[model samples]
Target: MDKRRIGEFEVSAIGLGCMSLSHAYGAPPPRDQAERVLKGALDEGYTFLDTAAVYGLGHNETLVGEVLGDRRGDYVLASKCGLSRGTERELNGHPDILKATCEESLRRLNTEVIDLYYLHRWDRRVPIEDSVGALAELVAQGKIKAIGLSEVSAPTLRRAHATHPIAALQTEYSPWTRNPEIAVLDACRELGVAFVAFSPVGRGFLAGGVRDPAKLEPGDFRSGMPRFQGEAFEANLKLLEALEALATEAACTPAQLCLAWLLQKDPIIVPIPGTARPKHMRENAGAAAVRLTDDIIRRIDEQVNETTVTGSRYAPAMQASVDTERTPAEAAA
Candidate 1:
């Protein structure tokens, strides 16, 4: 697989989003099975693994540690801090919280130095400088390699970068999820920050895997996303039709086509498409080889245009947690 810069390290263009192995998307694959799947991803050329301290309250990081700890030198490990204990809504980016979180994550990941450490979200209660200053201190201490952010608005990104060079910015940047395009994407480009696209497959909705929200396993996060509920999903599914001809033309699955589209958008854009299935993992990694021509890019634009995208990335309460969009109206506007 080709590599892209996340900081000083060059990671696989198609990184594996390890959250689904234990956090979201219903019951995680059994431990023994998950180990095999993760190993399969590594064998399939994924040198980048993304997890978070908040995911399953550190369960995901532990799983990554247990599976790949022995081969620590094989991949670049990234995790996040700032999420309040056991909750998704509350954020604590205080220096104390960040220091404690960094130590705990190190213990769980079985790594002495986290390759990339991200302030998961902007905390309104905490000043951005304090949070980023702490991260810069961590780099000096050799506790973390590079610093990053998630779902930050353009101004927030600039402010954070001024405190410390933000190596990357992780956010939802799939074809259907265009929030990054509003300003965040361009800001990243201008500042030389690598843009890491999470949920690059639209939680698999854009891949033609999710037909109905009800079909998803109980407790799946997608059920609560505005784009996947009621008329929104029904309308969005129609967008898949626009992708059929292009997928056939590319001789790849709809999911690979989507990955190809993302990779083609910007050399700095790296998509971490997560899946516990070894087959799916291989499929996403293979997308790095998939190429898009001028015509295909135009077709993808038409596909996105064909669907009248509706709904917010999160529910109102969960939406409140995103710093990328200060208000629901602003996101829609």
Candidate 2:
């Protein structure tokens, strides 16, 4: 596996987005199986593992702590704050709340210091400096090694970076969803901050596994997402046909094709595509070896550009948490 720098740490190019095994995709995987997959990822040379306190109300972090706590030195660990778990979940980026959340995350993660700590969302009520300042205090106190911002716009990123150097800006970026290109990507490049691509598989749609959105269980997180509902899903499924052919030509699975495409886009971009099965872990990790030629990439992107993906990446309520990003047409305007 190849390594890239995210702040002070150099981790594997392909990382593990550990949210699915416990939180977002559907029902949580059996504890034993989930543990095996988490451990298997580290053994497979995936040195970057990402989790957040908001995921499963901290269940994901606890699981990772139990499974990988003993092997903490083996990988780079990143977690998030700014999302509260009180009577109702809310974005709270106040300095005091951030401090309390960091302590809680440390206990749940069973770690002395987190390698990368992020403000999961910019709390509208608090200034970016206050949130980032709190993170800087953590860095000074030996609580976290680096700072990251998720779903933030370029101007918000600048404000936070000015408070303290941000290590990375994480958000959704994939072949089907290319919103980061409008401004976020360029902002990170200019500021020398790494861009972490979460949900690089389009929330598992690009992997060809989501054949029917209607089949998703009641509590499934994806069920609430705009893209996974009604006609939008059916339309998105048709778009996959183009990618399927390209993946076939590349001798890779659609999931790996998606990872490889993101990998080839920029050296600073690190994708954390996760799964419940260890076998799938091997396949996702193998994307590092699957090569895509310039022409193949051009053809694949052309197909993506021609196909219009319907539905917002998140529901309207969730979309409010993101700081700054624009549609391609909006950016042009």
Candidate 3:
């Protein structure tokens, strides 16, 4: 696999997002299967692994620790703080909370130091400076090697960088989710921070695996997503048809097409697509080798975009949690 820079670490161009193995889309995968996916990613040359404390309320980190802890030196380890589960999901970016969270993550991850630590969600109640200051302290103490921010706006990124250099900025970015284009991408380019694109395959929709939202597992989060419901989902599927044709022409799967598109977007962009199945994990890793032509990329731009996509990426309540920049139409809504 090709390599990219996330701060001082040079990792695979396509990293593995270890979320779905333990949390999110639905019920957690069986322990043996999840472990195979984790170990398979390393064997597949995915040198960067991303997980967060909040995922499955610490289950994800613990799984990663158990499966990959023994092979820690083989890859770059990244985890998030600030947002976690107590009695319920919570966001706390206070210095003390961050420090304590790091301690907990360290124990759960079974690692001495995390390679990249992120403030999962900017706690609106706390200033970005304070949150980043706490991360800076972690850096100083060698608890984490680099600091990262997720789902943040450009201005927020600048403020945090003013506090301390941000190694990376992660958010949901795919053909259908164009929020990052508003400013965060340019901000990261300007500040020399890497941009990590999560859900690069449109949250499994682009992979052609989720044809019916109703059939989704009982607790599957995508079932509640706007684009996966009723008329919105039907419209989005139409967009997917054209993308699938393009993928065929490229001799790749729809998921690889989505990932390759992001890889070709910019050198600073690294997509950490997640999956529960080892087969899909290998397919995602293969995207780094799938090249897209200029005309194909142009057609993809014409076919899928903010204006063409149906429904909001998140519900109103979920939307309010992120600090990502919004388009005028979305902001007005």
Candidate 4:
């Protein structure tokens, strides 16, 4: 896989997102299976790994630490703070809390200094400048090499970057989720910050993994997502047919086609698609090699997008937490 720069560090174009190992999707894989995926990612040539403190309330970071801590030198490690620990979701970007979160993350990650530390979500109650300033202190103390922000708008990104050079900005970006295109993408390029894309396969929808949401495991979080629900899913599933056909023509899996499209979209974009199965990890890594033509890219843009897709990315309460720019329709809604 070709390498991309996350600030000064060069990492693989396709990174491994470690969330599914301990949280989010469903019942996590058995320890052996999870270990296989973590070890296999490095063997598959993935040079970037992303995790967060809120995932499984620190379980995810610990899992990454236990499994891959010995080989920490092999890849650039990224983790997030600001999202508070609990059974329910919450955001706490207070400087003291952020600093405290970093201390725990470092201990859990089994690292001396995290490569890229991001403020997972901006707590609206706390100014972004102050939150970023806390991160800047970590950089100064050699606790983190660089700072990042996730699920923030272009304007918020500009403000955070002004306070401190944001190494990267991450969000749920895919063919189906086009929020970043609203302005964040342009902002990253202007500021020379890497744009890290999470859920690059439409949260497994485009991967041909979940044909029927009714059959998803009982605890799988996608079962609760708007795009996976009844009417919206039915409408969205039709869009997948066109995507699957394009994948067939492109000679790649739908998941790979999605990642390849993002890779070809811009030089600074890095897609971190997560998986619990090592086979899927290898398959996602293969996407870095899948080349897409302009025609295929154009068709993908035309077929699956904010306008064509049904349902918003998040429900009202969850949506209120993020600072990302909403689509015109979403804004009006």
lDDT for each candidate structure: 0.86, 0.88, 0.92, 0.93
The positional error of residue 66 in candidate 2, measured at the CA in angstroms, is: 1.0
Single out the weakest 10-residue window by summed lDDT for candidate 3. 84-93
Off by over 4 Å in 4: 86-89
lDDT of 1 by residue, 252-295 (tens): 88899889999999999999998878888988988999988889
Give the poorly placed runs of model 3, Cα more than 4 Å off.
85-88
In model 3, what lDDT does residue 211 have?
90
Model 1 vs. true fold: TM: 0.95
Local error of candidate 2 at 143, Å?
0.6
Q: How many angstroms is residue 83 displaced in model 1 relative to the true structure, after the best TM-score fit? A: 1.0
**Tens-digit lDDT track of model 3 for 1-333:** 999999999999999999998787878889999988999999999999999999888888888888888899999999999998432478888888889888988989999999999999999999999989988988999999999999999999999999999999999999989999989999999999999999999999988988989889988998878889899999999999999999999999999999999999999999999999999999999999999999999999999999998888888889999899986657766
Per-residue CA lDDT of model 2 for 1-333, tens digit only, reads 988889999999999999888776778889989988998898899999999988888888888998898999999999999886522366899999888888988999999999999999999888899989999999999999999999999999999999999999999899878888888899999999999999888878899988988888767778888778899888887778889989999999999999999999999999999788888888999999889999879977887741377677777677767776857533343
Better of 2 and 3 by TM-score: 3
Error of 4 at 240 (Å): 0.8
Runs of candidate 1 with Cα error greater than 4 angstroms are: 86-89, 305-307, 325-333
* Residue 138 displacement (Å), model 2: 0.6
* TM agreement with the true structure for every prediction: 0.95, 0.96, 0.98, 0.98
Cα lDDT for residue 242, candidate 1: 70
RMSD of each: 2.0, 1.9, 1.0, 1.1
Candidate that would win on lDDT: 4
